[model samples]
Target: MNLIKTAFCLIILICSSIPVWSQTTGKIVDTDRQPVEGATVVMQLPDSTYLGAAISAADGTFSLEPMADRYLLIVQHLFYQSQVVKGQTRDAGIIVLEPKEHSLAEVVVEGERPLVTVEQGKLSYDISAISKKHIVNNAYEAICKLPGVQDRSGKLSLIGAKDVTVILNGKASTLTQEQLIEMLKNTSASQVQTAEVMYNTPPEYHVRGAAINIVTAKAADNTLQSELSATYSNQYFGSYSGNVNFLLTKGKSSLNVSYNPGYSHIMTVMDLASMHQYDGQVYDITQRQKINTKGWKHNIYAEYGYQINEDNALSVGYNGALSGNGKGTIDVNGNFQNSHNDKVQDSWLHNVFARYSSGFGLDLGVDYTDYSMNDYNHLESELTGHTRQLLDYTSDQKIRKVSVYADQSHSLANDWTLKYGVRYDYTDNRNSQLFNQTEGKDNVDNSSSRLYEQIANLYAGFDKEFANGLYLSLSATGEYYSIGNYHKWSLYPQASLSYSPSEKHTFMLGVSSEKEYPTYWDMQTSTTYMNAYEEIQTIEGLRPANVYSVNANYLFLQKYMLSLFYERIDDYFTMEMYQAKDRLALVYRTQNWNYYQSFGMSANIPFSIGNWLSSQVNATVVNDRNRCDHFWDIPFDRNKWACMLSMQNHFSVGSQLGFDLDAMYRSSMISGISDTKPVFMVNVGAQWNFLKDKASLSLNCSDLFDTMRMKVKNRYAGQHIDLNMGQYSRTVSVKLVYRFGGSITKEKREVDSSRFGH
Candidate 1:
């Protein structure tokens, strides 16, 4: 309690010392008086010093704070010529610009948007600008439209890097990567302003590897508001699900809550032909298997925020999920087995954050999470022609985690920034399994593990713009990590250089290094039997993987982007399946491989047809190579080529309706010993708004051709397995949303406790 009070007092002191500035407002429009949304408005002092910048809202209106009574204002938009207005006051009134094509160069095409831009080592995509040309339903879909983002086997990745993290509103969350992806899929992207991608994490971010930070727009024009939304989905395997969300905002306080309860039914079928060398003879085994599963899931989340002042704020959040028992039936080689399982998880977070205009920022946060899961399996089989057999298995697991961190940042002259932070994280996990044979003995296995970690990081760097439109950023992080009885310290370095040779082109080059840590469960020395023919295992003493990469990028007219990159990973973990005991069963395990390398190139282009239809396309090609071996002592080496092509289209029908079409295709790829087949998917959606634009209804159909399935072939010495997996890809969904508000308002952003929970 004393610590809390002390921290609160510190933040209050910082906030109280901040100097207040006078506010300003203005609007921008084209020569024809059409609103120029997404225009950059900047205020400059007499000495040409930057006061601040803001983006023109959808209505071409903007607000800023300036320290001087009279200043110079600059308005810039890609579609329009730059405008400079001097002697501007608090209310600058209306500023107009001529179309860019009217100038000598004719650089910018009408109705085209500069969707992607790189500044000071960060790549940012203006979501609102892109959404004008492409159809984006949710935040996840919006991210998928970025330059290098791809969905591979139902998982999101950036430029072939699978180890990526997400940050919301400059704060980390306590959800797993998969959970975060789900949440983003359900979240509407209309609330977001920009999506920033970082290939090499900076020291101030306090995270490793590639990351995507979602920056949300602060509401403008304060007014009480509420939004209610609901969605219904019909998935594959004859299952249906529904969800609802409600949000309320008034003044500086806002509340958001959601609930989702759904059921899942799925069936998997596989045909296998295996050959094993036993007793100087090769035996051929052929079998057909079918598995069916059904289960129910419930998830809930609530978050509330209040602004204590202009610079300080507090927030609290909760997330919980529960899954009911799932019944499974399997038919393998004329043998039958049955099983069931259930799980529950809960987490909470609280944060105290403060920001000062004097270039000092502080964040103090704490988070706690608890997870419990239990599964009971009963198997009945009759295949040997002797007698009916029965077996029982029970597994139980529990995990608890607590994390606290304090971070501070200070700004210096000449665009230099200094940051330092410390974090304490603790975790405890317990797992137990019991196996019994009806006619034989009983086997019991138990494992308990605990980890206490502390990390302290310091980052210092300078971002400077020199002559000839050249900008450079150099930053390095010194981090010390202590876990259990081991202690290590390392320095990560990052650098980037970019130059705009002309209005038509910008070039960039960067290099950085990052580390990838293993998940808590991935390092446990435990074994789990999934069924009569499959088992799961993990190796102990797993170490963090290290990555080093470099990239070069070129931007043509800000509407088209091209990039090339190379990445190398050491101590990489690969998942492999092997034949156990003469092809009787399969064992799945994760083991560290020698190394993995990839070289890739990507391109993103946006275009418009007339004024009612627009589209964006993205493509990538890569050469992937890996040196690894199967668990059954078989050497494996592979060098494969991969490619992905995606296109999104948006069409406007009159003034109250809109339609969208999206498609993506990927060539074959390799993961460990498994070679996956090619896959493609197409989706279409339509939205209608009514009730004075306060209510919206949207209908969507996914996987129109039903090709979003995973087909893989695993091969090793004297063993082969062909497998197929299906998910909820082929589905139809409808969403209804209603809002009651006078005007949208902005809320203060606070650094939360998400970074620690993970």
Candidate 2:
């Protein structure tokens, strides 16, 4: 308790010590005197302590507040050469940055490649530079090598972030999580130029929270290029995958297509124990199940683009996936159940965008998606030990949705910007289930629901640099949302203050608000069964969760970062196990929690060991608390502290060969009633490039120590449950990729992923 109090007091003191000074403003321009938007201006003291930083607005104007009159300023941009100037004037006047010629000869070659770079609070990794020394099979593999990125059971997450969204270029991904992972696995690293990480959600992106955008380079030659790859992996079973991608360019038009297919066989086991109380009675049940599944999955994507001019373009894309042939068996207290499942999804999108030299931008897009799934099960039970009871169940579900949106941005005088957008989405969902008993009448359950949502948002923001190395940005968004029968208007405000007291040190504080809505399944009122002992029934009318967050960040020499964050959630909705009747199974439902609170600290450190080895280490500690006695019908509050650590090491033998070692560990934490168990994993991989970079081979062993697993314990009210789930761990994989093209060169391309999504 004393330590916590001391830390709290220190934070308060730091925040309260921020000094206010007179504002200093200046304009940034290119060599030709044209206003340069997005150029970064950083102010630093003589000792290299960071004071503050700002980005030039559309009018190439920036303002800074520094306590001292004299300071050093550094200006940088991708298209311009970096510049430094020392000044003591409150107004530095016009500053010009020399334009950089995009030629290979002018590129600077460093002995050791930088894995990550921080600019304007965003982290970006250069894939091309990293791939020169490491073997990367796909975009996903490259992403795993990035600092502070974690892969948990095939899902990628960032440190200090509750949820993450992936965007292609600047658009939200149209594919689901599984589909996105598969797509990334099939895409070669050579096709991706850079991956940018944004912790603070920008106004242009409708979604809130952290996001990662993968940017791809355009084909330099006016010809066709293609790639083919094959991979094989062994877990408890064998899996095989293959992919083919093609890129074609002619004049101002281009087309890209990719297809991937995979087959896998898996074995799993589960043990569950439950204690339920109802009607003044208690029941204890134990069950063990073993299952085997064999399946195949396919992904197909195609995109077309036409550049009407330098500032106008049109894009269309189609993405689809299908998976089926799944079978499993379960035994519950000597009772047996068999099940099978299949799924299919398809999506299409079209977009048009235009930009003008007068700082005006417009984007319009529309998308449609359809998805369906089917599951069949059969059960046999013998309660009396004399008679055999047979039950058959089948369920079918389908969803169709349409979305349309338009957004525009306009630049104002005095380095201010305004963005506004409107979006419409409509979804129709249908679910049906049939239950049959040999000695009883058949029962059927069916439900059909439709939802229509409309949203309008407006945001205005400004970035100003001040004297005494202080920089600030203030922005707020007002959104009107109409979903089904619920309509409301909300304001999401944002404020940030940063100071660079010296050249190598920087401090920043930010506050923001956002909201999250319940998923379609979370709002469903249908009963779903998990084997014979458990069932789930979710109720409707769940409200969206509102979150207010505060964060403080410190960066040292652009290589080390430490962050402290806190968030408070109101009306949080999540799943919990409940038992309502006597002699009945436990049912899982989504209920509103009164409130949720969390505080966490994270650190990222990157260093080099010797001349050939480099490593990055990241650690985070968090305290989670929840209070919701009223909704649970009992006094239940949760508080727990969790910690996670991840380390990545890269060993380079030369430019053509590289090896990697990675390990991750996470401590248990409480989520609702479940107390999760600890998990740890280690991985090793190596890559070799031959045939003048046209052919590449990679070998990897995942979960080398076989210490990765999921276990959870839940106890609340009159229900107690323990579960240990299976995992696809300890996998050894090998991949070979080949590229064929003519006159290939990396050319930067500006493409917004939002152009296609559903």
Per-model RMSD to reference? 7.4, 15.2
> Candidate 2 clash total?
29
lDDT of candidate 1 vs native?
A: 0.66
- Model 2 weakest 10-residue run by lDDT: 742-751
Alpha carbon lDDT of each predicted model:
0.66, 0.68
Q: Tens-digit lDDT track for model 2 on 349-437? A: 22222221222478877776666666666665544334444656665656666666677876667545566666666666555556654
Q: What range of 10 consecutive residues in model 1 has the weakest lDDT sum? A: 742-751
Candidate 1 lDDT tens digits, 1-758: 37435733654453344332234777787776655667888889878999777777644666665568879888998778898888656778888988876334766445545567766657789987665555565678788777778766557788746467777765654455556666676566665678988776655566656788888765432222334566667764666555455444444665555556666676666655555455666645555666677777666665667766768777776666666565666666633232222222233323333322222488776666667666666665553434454556665656666666667776677656566666665656555555554432234355545555555666666667766778877777777776567688878888878898786888888788776666666666766655445668776776667787888888898778888988888878766777766445577887787778899999888788777888888899999888765345776778899999998888987656889898999999987777888999998988886775556788988887778878778765666777665644577878776654311223223222222221
User: How does each model score on TM-score?
Assistant: 0.79, 0.77
Which candidate leads the pack in TM-score?
1
Query: Clashes in candidate 1: how many?
Result: 4
